[model samples]
Target: MTAPKAWSYSALSTYVSVCTLKYFFRYVANLEPERSFSRMYFGLAIHAGLEAAYRAWKPDAPAPVGVAKKVFMDDLTIRLEDPMIEFKKGETPEGLLTEGMAVLDVWAKEARYEEIISTESEFTVPLVHPGTGEIFERGLKGWFDLVVKDPDTGEPVVVDFKTTARRFSGDKLEADLQIRVYSYAIRQLYGLDRANLRLDVLVRNKKPVFQRLEVSQDSEGDARLFELVRAAGRGVEAGVFWPNDGSIWCGGCPFTQACARWHDNPDALRSHSEK
Candidate 1:
């Protein structure tokens, strides 16, 4: 008898086959291993920097400098064990820190007109569809980078900050599940419709791209997303864990060795890549 998995966007938006086993390894066996990606550390540093910078940003206040990066990396060093991220074996954190700082600087200038409502806001709500009766026993949990109101129209907007290797168009954002989930979740908690959406993509060695994307879904579209949550919950309950043989995501997954052991030879789990 397995316990019901707590529903979350990370578990739902990803492929069920991959996500289910990830859950199995993590919660069931408590054997999920975590890998440290320098890039992930870099991204977190940038996110923390932006969160600090934005929290101090006021429509009439002077834009502060040198504080955001300082605040973020100060704590990050301890978290990542102060490892020198070897981008090319001799690479240092100087360049990466500068780049993330550049993004905050660019945003400080560009976001003068926007009034921020909230940043790093979080929510956990019952998994239910808006304007529909479909509700699940499991709940959804998530965090928002920023929530602001349109200065001119007084409309509420949700803004997400990203540290991307390349630029992304508004079209891709319009189709992303993460943003849709946020939009839907916001409405459910706030009881407001037409909450605008924006994605601030901070690209390395390039000026930050600010994109305002639309997030509107009909009941069917809403139902589609809710179904993903339902399906994840169902799969977890039935212990329907199976290896997704053809998935591209399997390559980067941390559980490959364990996954191989379950289906392949048990002795070969130590060296998953060999076979």
Candidate 2:
């Protein structure tokens, strides 16, 4: 069992919570996915497009509507060249480009940031327990999608963009681990007690819908995040990884073949065992 040098929000949530087996496969064995998901490609393109638009934005000027669409199409075209990208049923590259353009159109019209503070801001900070002042060996690292000054409050707000099949529920918004981690990071970086967080969600529908959701943030969740990261690290050290069978995302996972072969192969586990 071994602990990583750092943990990202995706590591704590997607790898640890989603499936610990995935953590082992990715981190310990360092195995690449058999194929990439089209959704991942689509999201990359969308983010790139949004980043471009936001970069081109000027104070009190019109939104970069055309720039957003063009960049999305260009990025999508480049990503589509990868033959290993697996598209969902009835999802074509052409269809995705069309949908992405439409989504960006909605974003260009609806998304507003009075003052763009930063885009793609990367941060790495020590993971400190709030309750006991315990500092962990593994640090936390992640990138902020966008940061802007709020029109009403004139305070820096962290905004993350998501392209999803449906809008997130209130409970989901409140419970999001990313928010907790981001809140913790904001405090560490800015020395601010409370972090203002927002999610700009793009819903995939016949006609796309854009939603701006504000998440309640405070120092309360920081301790929980610290504990969660600690537990995940402990689990990794103990080599406690098991497939999350019957999960909805299992079918789309790139590790299906490797997961199926795990039980028959003690060598795989031994490869990462503490010497």
Model 1 is weakest, by summed lDDT over 10 consecutive residues, at 266-275
Clashes of each: 0, 0
Relative to the unseen true structure, what is the C-alpha lDDT of residue 80 in candidate 2, on a scale of 0 to 100? 92
TM-score of each: 0.79, 0.95
Which residue pairs in candidate 1 collide?
none
Collision pairs in model 2: none
Query: Roughly what TM-score does model 1 have, to 2 decimal places?
Result: 0.79
Q: What lDDT score is found at residue 154 in candidate 2?
A: 75
lDDT tens readout by residue for model 2, 1-275: 66778888887886656888877787788798888888888888888888888999887888888888888899889989988889889999889999998898888788654688899999999988888999998989999999888788777899898888887776776668888888889878888878999888888888999988887577888887888888888887777788889998687778888989988975667667664
At residue 169, give the lDDT of candidate 2.
73
lDDT of 1 by residue, 11-34 (tens): 665435355555566555667364
For residue 93, give model 1's deviation from the true position in Å: 3.3
Query: Among these predicted structures, which one has the highest TM-score?
Result: 2
Q: Provide the lDDT at 33 for model 2.
A: 89
